[model samples]
Target: MCECKALPIRFDYTPKGKVEALGGDLEGYVVAGTKPAAIIMLYDIFGYTEYPQIKQVCDHLSAATGFTVAIPDVFRGKPWSMAKSPAKPEDNLIGWIQSVGSYAKVSSDLKLTVDFLRARGAERFGIAGTCWGASIALTACSQPDGVFEACAGLHPSLFGKDKEFAEALLRPVALVSARGDPLETVQEVVNGKPDLAPKCIWKRMDDVEHGFCAARGDYKNEVVTQRVAEAVQLLAGFFTSNVA
Candidate 1:
């Protein structure tokens, strides 16, 4: 896995429009490359980090696709420890705030992020999110075509919340999951939708659990990684096919 610190590109953008209330500067690292193939990666419930696994996603995806990637910090300067859910109720709220912000906040930030990328030569843009971020990616894709042309949701945790929401998407999507995961069934909704343009759905490695990206640890699945890389390729292909 490569280091997140290794990438040298950076961008600071002020979120505009209705998202201004959730207003905060969006920060992301640009892996410098040519010809404007950009991917905006959404993080898990854990948020963006300097973590090896997170960095590996960016590094491998860039190496495989030759696309400039930028992963934004959505926690607005919070640390990653907030996801630690304790048995006590008081501890839970602190943990929740530390980890997941309000859904509106996340959606707004993402809208701003996509807009910013589009302004900065990201014509072939796609969204990829893991776990909680996968749900966020779904919401962002539901918006009437502006920012993201495609979305890839991995081990998504919130795909079945509202059927109407799933019905609203007008883009291409790819969903990856495992059988033991709680959200495995959720991927079905995204898959079943005929309204979505280009689609790929999989729940391979049936025995794997939630947080497969991290839980699997150093023993990464080359096949699954290749699948993800292929999804990015398809997503970039979708953008080229549709937007270009």
Candidate 2:
């Protein structure tokens, strides 16, 4: 995956879920549910509250699909320090990715989150992520050893390596992308592999910017919110049908 820079984000809405411990040193905001399954919702590098929409989207998914969504604090207590854009040279995004957002580290956290859900009586599992988090989620889905049964990536920032991720997918995938994303790469792969097409859902929100589906989205704009709702519908539909 390539390094991504931070853009503007909005925390215009309040999150409805409560923060709780996910066993050991892990803690995250979990949207309560009555279903027997759970979906692990990973946030972008900005962490949870920096983009309140991350948690809000989890709440929406719970309400829509009745799946208890676990939005883990993958960054723990320390999210990205640069609150505003135009990052200084000292606040390097790649450096943070190599540490807090590294694949080895987040993949371990993903396993822990799945373990916590399994302990909570969740018999089935799915994984979803936005922006940088999507890279991690897709990487896990691509591996046969990964615990998730299905995965979703919203406005994923894969540095144009969608073909690599697509070919390596060991389970179903749902990609809800922005206009700027590399949608055609995966499209071409699935076109050749007819067996893989049914296991995937690719959607593009043409009106929104790169981070529209994640917290970096400005929900203050009516169009962005509407498109986000569409994204939620696509994700909820994918997990409900594929996670079984």
Candidate 3:
């Protein structure tokens, strides 16, 4: 029984393609709490439109920790349909990956988000993502003096043999992965890296695949769903300890 509840949110459309940044209107949700903390979340390749499950995650996190969660639409203003998306899921993910603002284009997206929440009377900040969004979460925190005081990821996709991205990640972060996931190889590469942030935390679950958090039967497992809920709880705790 999750006490998670969803609050109405406003979308502030940002055109990043022209600005060359993490553009698009941000999707915001507030959960009932006293003195809410603020957090930003990124979605996976399936895009935010495909699954309503992520809203549950946001609501759950907010209910557990009193955080004002904001999820950004990074799909270039394009919605995705499970049955009608043009590119394969992986390709769609990669496209968004390549779309993240360059180092020079970091702009005010993150900072503006922090300011927005603070303006709404929030006091703490955090970030989290899943699958493709997981990597972005890590990178966002890696920025010097990142607005997010705490961050987490489940089944992150940062398992490349190279440390290029990992090295840039300089903030404390948590990673949750499934042992049976096809992307487990990438998880291994990330966990095995020697230069991971001193605050990087890693957890691996067995009998789960890449998109276990997704509601789709193809990737969802009851046990794994339980595991993901647990992971979300852990992330809320981290945000509590570090952010608020």
Candidate 4:
């Protein structure tokens, strides 16, 4: 396994937002707004149920960008834990993915999320994810009728060696990779497809590792806050130009 795939042990964020059912057993932490554009945030293996930093990020994006941002419970209620689980991290991640159903099912769930937002007056849309969630964002972008006008992936995972998936993206996308990320493969894919070059933005965080966007609440410093702020800015800029 790559070093970047390791999960952080800290849980540093203070939870935010009101819990609301998103229909069909799906629930999410919604930062409400009256904006015409909405952003859907997919969670990594850790899930978004009790994670404070993830919720904080969602809230920040909504407040900062004036876009309705929703982070759905993709794992339903059963989020994987690195601190309490007995299995290896990799095994637990795989199990969690399988438990939620296949990739197709996850993709369908995302579409449902988009529909839910659209019904609430949101016209354009943006999607962002980290790690495992990044893979889902890619899938969402591939949907023929997807509502996403823009998408962003942070230290993305699970996008196999094949280039067809990357080639399928139709909307503008920003991919932020950590220092050790296997982004060369994706870059190759983008390079080979001249049509995709204009629509794709690749940013590299030379000093950070995967999962650096979330705060573990262990340190009361400015570093994590700054990093998160930078990431949000990048996504915001992408959405501002493409969706907002």
Candidate 5:
């Protein structure tokens, strides 16, 4: 489960993108750039509207990687909560995923996002997801007719552990795992598998929690900032090398 209250809202950094409709009535924050390779960034359980940090992270990745990043509103307009802590269990992090139709609905929405980008002249694509979003990214890349060229999962949760999921990775993938996360088990599986090893890059962040990548003012210490920078650099390199 993610600690939603760990990070504080940052009002200083405003997002550079505009929320536009991407067919199927789904809207996303599209950050325009010059790169031919576009990346579809899936949001965590907090959804897009819950935190400004999520949008800021999207902006940073778009500028840093030079990839036209699009963050689809997977929950449509309904986010779990903007409050640091939810008053009810149904509104908590775990309950929110259950309420939003989970991976099945998110994966369906991701396909629409891919089509939207494809129509906009994006030649290549990299799909990156965090936490609950990572599960959807993994599933998207697993499909035989999947359009993404590269996929990344940062501090993933609710990932499939079966052999089929491992065998379905058709392109390069970077898995950024936090220490002590159950997601590390899948990271180990991807690392140990002979067939998956050549294109798989597993990076484990020591002494950090799941939500460390997102810039949180509350947790903005030197070490957290460094880890976030390192994670961004790693993803930029992974997308550059794999998506061409």
Candidate 6:
């Protein structure tokens, strides 16, 4: 089985983006883009309020790529309670996951956000996510009705369903795998990108653990900060290359 381990909650940083209404059910933190190309920044189980670092990353990507970066509050303020680390069926983390259950459920929420974006004149699109959000980002792109031009999944926890993620790729993708995440599995995901497979890349950050590029990232650590900076460049460059 694929491994998933949640780290301690972090509260060291602040984000510059502003939270605002996009339309019906389109509330999120955003950095406006001039290219009219936008990226949906998906969050981990921790949600945005408790882990502001998610928005910081979104800001970094927005700064680096000059694209509109936004992460909607899909949880509606009720995210994983962090009652359990590894997650048990009885815990709030699993409960939240079950509530969101599959990407289809989350996709319905995303459709609202996408509709808001479309109404705002957004023409190009990209997506990036961490952990559970990472899994959904990949899963979303695999769907026949997927609208993203490219996708980036940082530290995806596929839970033994790596093949499904690989086979679901319909566009260019970049996966930053956490240390100890199966290399072959992530490689298969990039390789499964059909005619666009050549543009897909799997970057393994052996120095960091899962969620290093998202909520769990320790910006205080110089090493993690450096790695996250590299990830910023990688993801920003990838999105700008295709979407911008």
Better of 1 and 4 by TM-score: 4
Residue-level lDDT tens digits of model 2 in 52-159: 788778888877777789988888878875464545778777777888887888877787788888888888888988988888888888786777888888988886
Q: After aligning candidate 5 to the native by TM-score, how far in Å is the CA of 39 from where it should be?
A: 0.6
Candidate 1 per-residue lDDT, tens place, 59-164, comes to 5456545556666778765634534532266556445733565557666666676666666666677677776677667667777855676766666656346455
On TM-score, who's better, 2 or 6?
Answer: 2
Per-residue CA lDDT of model 4 for 1-244, tens digit only, reads 1012112222464444676777788888777765788999887777765555677767766766778888878778776675754457666556657767346767767777777888878888889888777877877777788777777887776546336657777766788877775466666777776765676677887767677764232224456556666666667666666777
Give the number of the best model, judged by TM-score.
Answer: 2
The TM-score of predicted model 2 comes to 0.89
C-alpha-based local distance difference test score of model 4: 0.69
Q: Assess candidate 3 and give its TM-score to the true structure.
A: 0.71
TM per prediction: 0.68, 0.89, 0.71, 0.83, 0.81, 0.88
What are the lDDT scores of the predictions, listed in order? 0.54, 0.78, 0.58, 0.69, 0.70, 0.75
Steric collisions counted per model: 0, 0, 3, 2, 0, 0
Q: How far is candidate 1 from the true structure (C-alpha RMSD, Å)?
A: 7.7
Clashing pairs in 5: none
* Superposition TM-score, candidate 1 onto the true structure: 0.68
TM-score-wise, the better of 1 and 5 is 5
Clashes by residue pair, model 1: none
lDDT at 112 for candidate 1? 70
TM-score of 5: 0.81
